[model samples]
Target: MKTEEHKMKKERWEKDMMLEHRRIEMEEQRLQWEQEQEIMFCDVTTMDDDQRAYVLAKRAKIAKAMSASVGETASGESGV
Candidate 1:
């Protein structure tokens, strides 16, 4: 029937819209991740020995803190 056909078309259109929205969201997330990666790893090769060591140490400290926070949150003791 025409009504059933219209209903099927509307459902397909809705599903297509949902897929497009998800694709856009994923693309935005990917872009944000790329930006963060660039910020975290910007041209370290041009730095001198001490500068490189300082950067490495700072990154390690940040990573440690992040892991600790994640652990706390996972255990439900985030201390917020």
Candidate 2:
């Protein structure tokens, strides 16, 4: 039927529009992430040796604490 054909076309058009929007959003997010990484690199590059070492140590400590918290949560959930 003509109506069915028209409906199919509309659905296809909508799907294509959604895909294009998602692609654009992903590209924008990727650009933002790259910019953030560039800024972080610049900050570290400008840091003196002691400051860089302190930052690295703090990052490691935070990572370790987060890992421990995640492990605890996982174990607790499994027990439930």
* Stretches of model 2 off by over 4 angstroms after superposition: 43-80
Model 1 per-residue lDDT tens digits across residues 1-54: 999999999999999999999999999979966755664687789999988887
* Collision pairs in model 2: none
- Runs of candidate 1 exceeding 4 Å displacement: 44-80
Model 2 agreement with the true structure over 10-80: per-residue lDDT tens digits: 99999999999999999997996675455445466678999888767766665676578688888885311
* Local error of candidate 2 at residue 59 (angstroms): 14
